[model samples]
Target: MIIEKGYDLRESLGVLWKNKNAAAIATGLVATLFSTMGPGLIVMNAAKSGGLTDAQAISWLLGIYLIGGLSTMFMSLRYRIPVVTAFSIPGAVMLAKILPNFAFSEAIGAYIVVAVVTLVLTLTGVMKKLVERIPVPVMLGMVGGVLLSFATSMFTAAINMPQIYGVMIAAFFLSMAFKGFSKKVPPIVVAIIIGIAALGFFNLITPIPLSLEIAKPVLALPTFSLRAILDISIPLFFLVIGVQNIQAVGVLMAAGYKVPINAMYVVPAIGTFINSLFGAHPAVTAGPSTAICASPAAGEKKEFRFIAAFSEGVFWVTFALLAKIIVDSVKMVPKEFTAVLAGLAMFEVFRSAFEGAFAGKFRMGALVAFFIAVTNLSILNIGAPLWAIFLGLLTSFIVERADFRADKIENSEAIEAAK
Candidate 1:
């Protein structure tokens, strides 16, 4: 039995390494790794900014990935969709904004409360109702809004680090050209390698002062309090559900697959509940990252995504096991490489959201949604996504109602003429 199990494991690795779908598979994994690492690092920094110690930050990182990723696996299985759920990056942004004043314990309390409320929303079906009411255009706008900052950052980085940026751009163009000949090597991987090499030659990378120490997660027990929930949970909830999930819906639908909103709600809730128990913040599906993975050109065969989830799960475990090496490697890589690489990887995400928000018979509604998300205004601490959908739906309803009335009048006239 042991030998058979080992053989199966080896076979799985062999299949992945020697995949016929190597280009697509590699693209998805490369993009996922790059995109997730940037945001994951940001979350760690945000935790630190919130006064969490290095150990706490590590715990938060490990816990978030484990809980969020495993739950996403089950969600993909249940929905038969290629959804890669994650903790809310915007929620982490909010934490960056709110943590200076509040205690980390309170932030955690709020996370738990939000998770509970989210679960309640799922059970009561209110969340599903709200999701259904949202129009596609508005959802696209919300997605665009979330990714706009990240995309803009790439250009900003190019200006800041011209040499590294040039290497990354060259890598992108070369990858695009080589793709016509061989579809195995991913552009993002090529970009990372080129960028690192360029930076190393320029003496930008300082040899990391290596200290060999194993970091272990220190688990904290949950202390749920109403005050903590009210202050922290509500804002975090609004950030994840409103901004994050809205974009997530847009990506799924834009790709010609409509996930049941209830499934969407429940998956994150499951992720969050597990995260809450393990002392991590709430989790949400990563629309931009998953969109990066689901590109048709990247060989996004349905099987590839399941393989991605399986691989990502393994990646997380391996990363955990070799935390020292992983951390060291991350530190060794220049930040400029990561920035441009991430933006390039998500180019498809930007294009899809743009098309979804502006194209088809839904142009007017989509335009309104786009404007609202770009404006980045908040109403009563609620983000722009809520309002974008609200306006899009209102406009769509009004136009549809007018069309209905006009059709009735036309039918009446036809009947009179026939009589």
Candidate 2:
């Protein structure tokens, strides 16, 4: 296994102090706000699907942010890179679909299984090889299939609460249309701020607990089920490896940051294992937040970017401590409103996944996978996403072997160039 050694807290702290600037701190704050505004609502939406009580959901929230925050700081300081990470948004969306079909304990079991599998890969020092072997188009096809509903849900949600959804949607697009404003304020924040005001004006906001409620997060035991392992764990594993960690690596690399890839896999695996015990999903080197933190908007000085990650981690820990407040806040809003926000939050990811799935080689296989996954089919307890991958690859092997050969040649040359 490739281990990143020589982490000195004192030196990293010194670097943070030396590089502290308004832009870096603001960038980190924006990343944190983006996560809480939309993805946080999505997390709540997914938990509700599993029928979790308030306390259980609070525990889930606390675990995810706490572990995720601490790990982000650790990895950034240890490697001097902007390592912004958290629980997988797409994985959580997929979980929302599968949770309705399985017990919560079984889902937790699947989470643990995924963490364990990734850890094993990390330890064996074959994580990169394993990830590289998966056909990118096929993997992305399955991802697009599972995530289609979350992005499309916004339209259906608007049908029910047109006023609130309309305001958010309008705000979202207006913010996206302008680049200067988007650098400071993310589109989701604009949408959410305006949407909340509209909600109050229309009296869509319900009367719920809005008082200080410190979270008393509790842990639960996991129950393993073969059905959930196949249906949930396998698909989630592919997402963490294929989508989250790998995507984060590519984003950072493009930003001119040479991160320790094995450490990236290993650290998130550790966080995933711990958080699953607290009823949270897999932790990952997150793509969206990493992109934000690594952007030039963070600061002109690339060396100081890790401080942005530090700022995000501190905010996450604070949010983790106030998980109950967040849950209570979500309760005050209508379910459809939150659903729309979550759906909108995932729109960018959905677009990327769709393009990656169908805009290249293995088109026929990806098409098959995409259609199969959209059905959310289940056979002998295994979910369609996993089957989508299998059948997608099989289709390619039979009728599109040339695509695989091309991919292999490209991968080999890339590996050689890296070496």
Candidate 3:
């Protein structure tokens, strides 16, 4: 039995090593680093607007990435899934709006409150039930809506920097066209190499000074206020639960994984709660990154593909430890190049989401939800995703009622004729 167990372990490791190729590594890096670009900027801007000193702002960001890395590493290993976790982007955007109004302590307090509320929801199974209740089409529509801008950004990048972005775009297409010829090659990886080469050739890539500096955690005691709770905490909780977590689960399902919804929610909730004490934003399952990790390009076998996520976790931890180096390296790359890369990386997700959302009985309702989500309409300070679900369901109920009535009438007529 011992020998057999050892053999099994060796076989698993062999599969993991064999499958962990350049494409998987590049995917993990892109998912971990590129996905955080927008949110990291938001956090910095929010910290600055909230009257934090330069040091405090840096500390806030460091804390977030550190905790985020640790949490993702732990959860991915624990579940043997590519469960990537990060600070919420919509939540960060919402924070940037509200954090300016409150003192830094109060903002920390609000973060704690949001985390606590998330934990409560998870423990009570409220979060799981809420996710299950949302129609799959509507959920897909919401995911598509949220990601639409990122997809469109590729064109925007080309318009902004045609020479650089054009090359990147060409690389993407060429890689895709030839992907069938080599199972080991991932198109995104090819794109990244081409992008870097172009940057170097154009003298556009500048080497930033980097050093091995570990980020220190910044702890702040909570100072809760009713206004802060209402403005920051509640909205953040809703955004994380309704937007981020829902999207994460959708991505997993679309990738053909049987997601442990309850465990997924609980793990992130606990991570967020713990991280809040150290001045980190709420950590939740990351959508775009998770999608990348769960993609078939990660590995040929579904069972062993988890190594892709594990590799991502390892990258996150490395980035956190060498935060300066990683961030500086990423910054050295042209913005347009990064944008092109992100858009290409997320193209598959967009395609899958659009197909799933519209190819169903609730097409019209799904369309309504898709439009609302894409517009990013917020009502009563709530995010658009929640409103999309509500309005979509309402539309489905009202419009589909006629179909129900018609079926009933047809059944009655057949019965009368038989009699």
Candidate 4:
């Protein structure tokens, strides 16, 4: 016998568009993008500074953003957790230094190698052991240090344009006030509205210069060679493996979820492989980027974060497909206005990173981690995150071992007294 049944796609669809889901997903998307845009913009500028032409830089930016967003969607679904990732800021920094002397194709070759090594570690579970050994203090410190530069830039911009900074500060407080009075309304969104209005009121915003359109994407194939691997891959690996992965894992744990390291590594690594083919850099897990997906406003439902991530990919891809229009639209805003928002958005992340490191009993350990991260040392080609972890664990181990010995001696004395 055959059975026929009727189903309502609208039922499932309605749940997603309901007041709760709509508010949650909307808030999550806004927070994630706003917080991340600072770093994304910085990475774009870094690419330009590194000698990439406008076309090349935008191609890398949009490609990585799209690939990374989609990768997060898959991982979030598989893990049932909000695990968002992005291109490593440290890797980008390394690129800024190396790209001047080397060809872009050579850089792409290096990115591919990093992704391969990351995949092997994840598939073999070797990366999990390395992740487990990381001390919390070190992770916190590494995050704090990496984000420090951006935070400083906000106030620096305020100095450059006092009026814009003044408005931003007002917007920050207004956002806080709104969040307090109404739990549903997100402060960042409100702040953004106010910021834009302020810019408009003061006549500071630039008018549209030309019609906006999405620029064409330039796709390329990988050219792997021994020289390319040596020049690009090794350094890129040190930066991504050492810093970006550590901070992303820490952010997840801090938000009260402990995802398996393999999920974190493999998903983004695969995305990076895809990105490399398109002449984009390797993407890694984003700490602040995930915070948006993990926000309370994203929804009480378990899948809200994943849903939010899924939606973000949709929006970003849409924006990417209209790259020229999006770029042109952004051009209409004064450069200083973008700078102000970028700095303001990162404030929360910077605060949390420092707080996590120094606000506990492990303040001493956190301090050690901070110094190591800020120093930005390299050992055998490995970078600061790994170094911070090494120092933090070393400190913790010594302190614990000393306590263990002391306990043993005290127990022996007590046993003798009983005898």
What Cα-based lDDT does every candidate model obtain?
0.61, 0.85, 0.66, 0.62
Which residue pairs overlap in candidate 3's backbone?
A: none
Give the number of the best model, judged by lDDT: 2
**Over 4 Å off in model 2, which ranges?**
415-419
lDDT preference between candidates 2 and 3, better one? 2
Question: What are the models' TM-scores?
Answer: 0.66, 0.96, 0.67, 0.71
Give the alpha carbon lDDT tens digit for every residue of 81-164 in model 2.
888779888888888888989888888889999999998888887787866667778878888888887767788777666777
Candidate 3's residue-wise lDDT over 1-419, tens digit each? Answer: 10011124355556667666766666576676555544555565456447666446556667667767776666555555666877776565445445666777887888888777877777776765555444556556765776677667788887777677877787778767875632345666677777788789889997878766776656777898877776667656765776677777767766666566766676677777776776667888887778878887775666655677767777766655654444446667766665576567666656766886788556677788778877765567655665666677688778865533453455345334422
What would the TM-score be for candidate 4 when compared with the true structure? 0.71
lDDT of 1: 0.61
Global lDDT of model 2: 0.85
lDDT of 1 by residue, 141-209 (tens): 655665676678788888887788876877777787876532445566676678878887888886878
Ranking by lDDT: 2, 3, 4, 1
Q: Candidate 2: which pairs clash?
A: none
The true-versus-predicted C-alpha distance at residue 93 of model 3, in Å, is: 7.5
Alpha-carbon shift of residue 405 in model 4 (angstroms): 13
What's the lDDT of the predicted structure labeled candidate 4? 0.62
